[model samples]
Target chain A: MKKTSVFGPTTALAAMVANPLAAQDAVGIDDKVNQVFADLTGPFVSLIFAPFPGTSFPWIVMWLVIAATVFTLYFGFVQFRFFKHAVQLVKGDYSDPNDAGEVSHFQALATALSGTVGLGNIAGVAVAVGIGGPGATFWMILAGLLGMASKFTECTLGVKYRNEYEDGTVSGGPMYYISKGFNELGLPGGKILAVVFSIFCILGALGGGNMFQANQAHAQISGIVGDYPGWITGIIFAAVVFAVIVGGIKSIANVTEKVVPFMGILYVGAALVILIVNYDQIGWAFGQIFAGAFTGLGVAGGMVGALIQGFKRAAFSNEAGVGSAAIAHSAVRTKEPITEGFVSLLEPLIDTVVICTMTALVIVISQQMIINPETGSYMLNEAGTAIATVDGNSGVALTSAAFASGISWFPYVLAIAVVLFAFSTMISWSYYGLKAWTYLFGESKTSELVFKVIFCVFIVIGAAASLGPVIDFSDAAIFAMAVVNIFCLYFLMKLVKTELSSYAARLDSGEIKKFTH
Target chain B: MTVKLVVGLDGTETGDRALAFAKDLASKIDASELIAIYVIEWSPFTFQTADENAKRHLRREEEIELATSRIVEPAVSALRKAGFNARGIVRHGDVAETLDKLTVENEGSQIIVGRASADGFTKRMFGSSTQNLVMHASVPVTVVG
Candidate 1:
């Protein structure tokens, strides 16, 4: 029995021999798996999500909601109380040049609006309607209205915590307010938060405010002049931007003061003409917007989806609770912070409510007139869809198409408008970015010159490179700034209240009289 | 050949110092002409009706000129008192741009300007508007802090 146990001894010997080799192979597999995982965890994640967050929910919309809610409650609805006064402020009724600032109230508002009223109104609305349908317009308008309060809160705090230079210059913005306001309130981590906000702001100004602007402007110019190359457009844009920004705030104000209103009126006038031409369809367009908002039409995932898209687009369009505008407004020449704050509220109203609505109406009416054979309904493809075969390009292209439908040679007109909007936006943003850069690096001639050069270079790069991902990340940074800024505003509401009351008392006592100029 | 001396004033401490320096130089050179220039950087008073604010702005300008005159005029008087020739001039724009224009207009004039404060970033970036005149002006420039 011991001798003939068949193959038992042989099998035992084979098993012993194969064990080491099998163990080695197993170890090799484990090592490979770990290497793959590390690669996936590192730059891969950033690359994939870097262009935009890879999430099912709209993070920007969520941030906007949180900002709106916090500011609304903290400021006690100051937007409504000061609506009339905000108009007065814009009219220069309370302008005082001796105040601790540089530019006028009107100039400050123009500067801030130049930041908010750029490609967002042009391409952002188109994106919304394309993805979410006409229903999204309703949600967008609502979000913009709420954004006014947020702007008020942030601008008020900006003035409250501004610093005065010994040479009679002034510096104030989220960088100063977040840290100083919190320090005044005895907050434990205020400085850290303030630094964090400044870092985000600087990145945002460079990416969203600066590069994005140059890119959009270059694209528009290239689109308009078939013979013109993008680099040429970028170079020229950079040169003009360099000249204006090099001169600092005074130059920026001088240029924006003239450019903003002219461009705004021109764009709005064109849209108004289109709207008037399609006057008959206006009622139906409104009906469709209202009806589609609640009971989403043939689109999949219906009402909830439509609402989400609308609010997201509106939030992106006006940048209402985003604290970026407050930085520009903070530089206004006035002792009372509330004066600038009032002017700030008009941004959302103009950018989202007026400009965005016009774009939305044009798209809606145009879509209604162009019937889709497949669905027997107005073509959604023309509005915006990922499908390449769609009737029009998304965002700016869709708006251009809408304009073309109503007027002959309209594409050229829109192309010019796009370039102007983008140009003004870039110039204004350059100042914002420069200030932030100066805040981070010391404010030396070399520092300023260096920032201006880098900024100019990015303008070229933005013109040439694909910005889908870069813009997404920039937009996110901007929203993140809003989150930090609104938090600071919430804590410092008491100071805003005190300033407002004092300003109001001055108005009542006739100490501050309206100026006719 | 008649020698001309031009001094820049903005009513700052530096400007006061520059005026005195220019007066002494004008007297030493026995110059035929002495010009004291003040550049007004746009008046906001035109936008305001308040007398106090307007006076405050005007008084500041006047004080700058008065101080400048007190330094230069006395020197001019001394030059005349000593049987020399002298004159005064004022203009407006950017300080540097105005100075360059003034220097070119009076090509043979020797320019005197205040030295910039090396204390802070603002002063450094702004650079005494006077230093700019020295760098770009066609005439010889002397900086006095």
Candidate 2:
């Protein structure tokens, strides 16, 4: 008798295993798919995440860190300066009564937040803390803070360069801005950049956005139900995703807007409850994070190791530098593109700084890190890194353990959250992937339907296999989007700055009308 | 030959003002009739299951019917009361584009709309339908204050 599935499709299959034919067949399929995935994605993942020659640091992490630091300084800390304005934009205070766009500022922000705020906050943060020690929380906070300006810069352009159709619909993203803005600037590389971006966006949509989510969801579910095949879980996940996308992106945006807030409150509420219950250890947990951030508790890379893990995982969590958020934010119905920029800064704050930190604190306070009480240091392995509670089990499993320690039933709750988070991310990414697909192929019913089907298929592929290399590749592919997107950002930052300053002046003079309910 | 004039209405008091102005102008210009189009604000943003998405077309038809009876019918009747040969129509979606399209399709020479006013917070957010007509309408547009 095995533990029954608490979350998704595999549960019933696991429970009624007296009929093992279906389950047994799925196991063979899972292994074959896993092998294929490993062979196909192995080279790509290695190339993408490869550390600098003779160094432990992966270049992609460095690429994001340097870009974030540059934007933070170059924009003069616009994230902080414009933080108040972003709040007002989200509140719909600065919106023109007659402005035309697809959705409200709040709706756009929520839609964008839904895509980035999912599994990474739950699972990615656990991995970061597990590998980099609690100190990773510190760098993650810093990375999230810097990532805000990157979000602001890209989203403002998402609206400014958006193509408005005769029907009053719009399409925007890195693809639009890269081509249109560069043409305006008389720069020659815009078309190439735009094309390159579309390619990555599609691959990323399949890998990181869809398959990674399906993989993680399958991983969590299978963990609970004593080694069941994943294809059943994959089929169910794919079916749900296809159902939503059938309504198109608006329906996706609408669902995301509602789900983002609900999940945010639910996850945060649970975190707050855990923190309150462990009120006495909250300060002590912070001390561990702060100390570990500096000392790394004898971790091999020491200070730099924690920083690298924190920044990498944080980038994954908030996806600020990645331009997918711009696609969602661009639909906002506002005359001022800068307002969307202001609103988007909040996404990273909520996703990484707040949510990721909560998970880290919970894990740290759970005593899962095995602290050296006398020296107030984490017990590290021979490799000089703190080990995960469940050996070889990282991501959501570690976080689940941390939470279940505080509340015995939390793992079940976490399983549900992971699935929901996975679903939310999948639907949102499907829209993102479809947009890119349409951009390359042209927007037609047949083309849109084609992309949607392909996306669903990948969901099945993701679910049916424990393709470690494939998930790694998709994760890298997601960051790969940042590589291309940030390149475009460098070219467009001046335009973004011009828009920001002009809007600021007009706001100062009260030229921009306000509607207060 | 009879000249045609398009009057964009919302069934609000302000929309009635635009209709009155259009009627007066039509008489001055010797236009034979007025076409009054009320544009319902419908956004593409919807959060619905796939089943709902498939049913959305039906839902939109219902909205169009509801808007015609509740909002457009009375506006048209009021125009007839004023001794104007007028036809009423109801449309949904992007306000500016739909009204603009109606003008072209109906062969209306010009469009008359009330100037957008910030009389309420709700009105403020939807924006001035008149302003949109002025900017986007295919024909010349009059924004009656």
Candidate 3:
């Protein structure tokens, strides 16, 4: 007889306990039923999400953005001051082959450019513009300009700390510079940072340098040569790559030395044709680019947002501060390390300033043609956002469509260009990965063979398989490498300043002859 | 007493130099036999047709015969002219693996290869087959730079 009173406190407590237990059981059943419903719809949920991650601006892009900015500020805008000198160096006006290294300055530039000027410029930029809007393009150019300084610093350091073998071969890049640079600065964690950088370099080279390039090449080849399987494209690519890469650095240098200039000129010529044909839209395009850069018109966000998108895309495209290019530039045949540094700065100009800008113009101008007047979005819809349906495909395909819009059958030419770009990129990256591998394992015949075989095998795998997570992780690893590299570059920048002054002094005097290579 | 020498060459300027080196070496030794071997890697064909297989086989044979006539034969002929008994033979497999097999088959044969400059993919990948043979072969190998 618990008193069941009209208003007893004990009765109320009992009711509360009893009601909650009943509710808890009911809620449990509801949860179970909902889980079953979710299980039935799990695949649908995942399918909708498959493209979302690809669309989002990765945090690694942010890391690159910050690094580019810091380097730009720290270097007092060295990109502008040395812009002329960079061009001069690439022209072999100050090149010296008799210097203690393996490859010429132009060859070094080509090798480094081949690594940076691949699918990342095409597909990566397309993805950035696709999600972040036209505003992203403006920031990309700004970031590219800043990236020059970063490139100058890292490459200068690469050349400075490079290890010259008894046979006159050179080994340099972040793995050597970060550790050795820090050691010179009397830093405590030089060895540890160097080891970590080497590990990241190895991983990055395998993923970003090796597989990503192979994957893109496979895509382009399969796209153009209909009825061909991805694996077939991959196998062919791998074989060609194996043929070239087996020749090692000198072979790579020789091929890139020729391939890079030709491809670069051809690509730029095509873009120039597009821009020239669309000369009428040039005014509006520039207006839109500048406006969208600062004001973010039609975009959901404002100027700051556009800046982020642009910077992220540009950083991803050129990889100016990413330190990967430093590895390629390190093997240049020059006693003056800063000469290669100046040449290295030209990478961002070609990749970001010229190539990426052309892509942005094509995309932006084409959007004007296809956007639906009623929807404030483009005619075609993607992920609930209205965008133009160029070539009935997206990303790199959109770029190809934009090219085809201006020049009929241009896609075929573009496809060939893309394939070559991808192939050369893959070859150069294989060397980068090999260098990192050799650094980790001893430079034995078995070790070299094992790395090449594994690298070639992954080419096929990247071409055939779904590697969303792997690529994402690898892209992150490359940006992390930039973080470590830029950190070292900041401290050892004095070395670069010293080298630049000495080189300039010699140039002023008549001591250093021009075009010696 | 007959001595055997196995020589490997890729169809390059360096490979030609290696053949010449092998011939000169064989001429120095009495009763030395020379075998010139080239390894053909597998390629993807649209369809494995009879014509394709025949073409591949004929090509390999022609390469072997040509090497004997143009490279190995000249070397052997020179060796014979120099008053040493010499013969030329060709075999196909992986450069390193074939060199190993040839060494064992030609029992007590010396292996010779050219010093490959790091200038091409093939040379880079395999190094000098002579260097590989020296490292792993049961017999002595001399790499000519």
In terms of TM-score, the best-performing candidate is 2
Evaluate residue A149 in candidate 3 and report its C-alpha lDDT on the 0 to 100 scale: 79
Best by DockQ: 2
Candidate 2 - CAPRI tier? incorrect
Report the C-alpha lDDT of model 1 over A384-494, residue by residue, as the tens digit.
332121464566777777877788687776676666767766665666666667777877889979988888887875554433445545555666676677667778777
**Model 1 CA lDDT for position B140:** 77
Candidate 2: share of reference interface contacts reproduced = 0.04
Reference-based TM-score of each model: 0.68, 0.77, 0.66
Best by lDDT: 2
TM value for model 1: 0.68
Model 3 vs. true fold: TM: 0.66
TM-score of 2: 0.77
Tens digits of per-residue lDDT for model 3, B5-115: 777666667767777787677667753566665543321211121111212334545656675676666665765676655566555444566666656766747777777
lDDT of 3 by residue, A1-517 (tens): 0000111122213323446875465446435744664566455334322332544444555666677677677766777877887877766567442221224566567667766776666666666565456767878887888788788888889888977665335577888887787887788787787777777777777777766666666656655554333466678877777766664434543555456557667767777888887789888878867776776655544566566667767877787777878877776656688887888888898889888888888877766324456744334344544244544455677777677777778778767767777776676667777777787786787998898888889887666443444554455566667767777777788877777778777878967767432
Classified by CAPRI criteria, candidate 3 counts as incorrect
Better model by lDDT: candidate 1 vs candidate 2? 2
Candidate 2 residue pairs in clash (backbone atoms < 3 Å): A97-B124, A97-B127, A98-B127
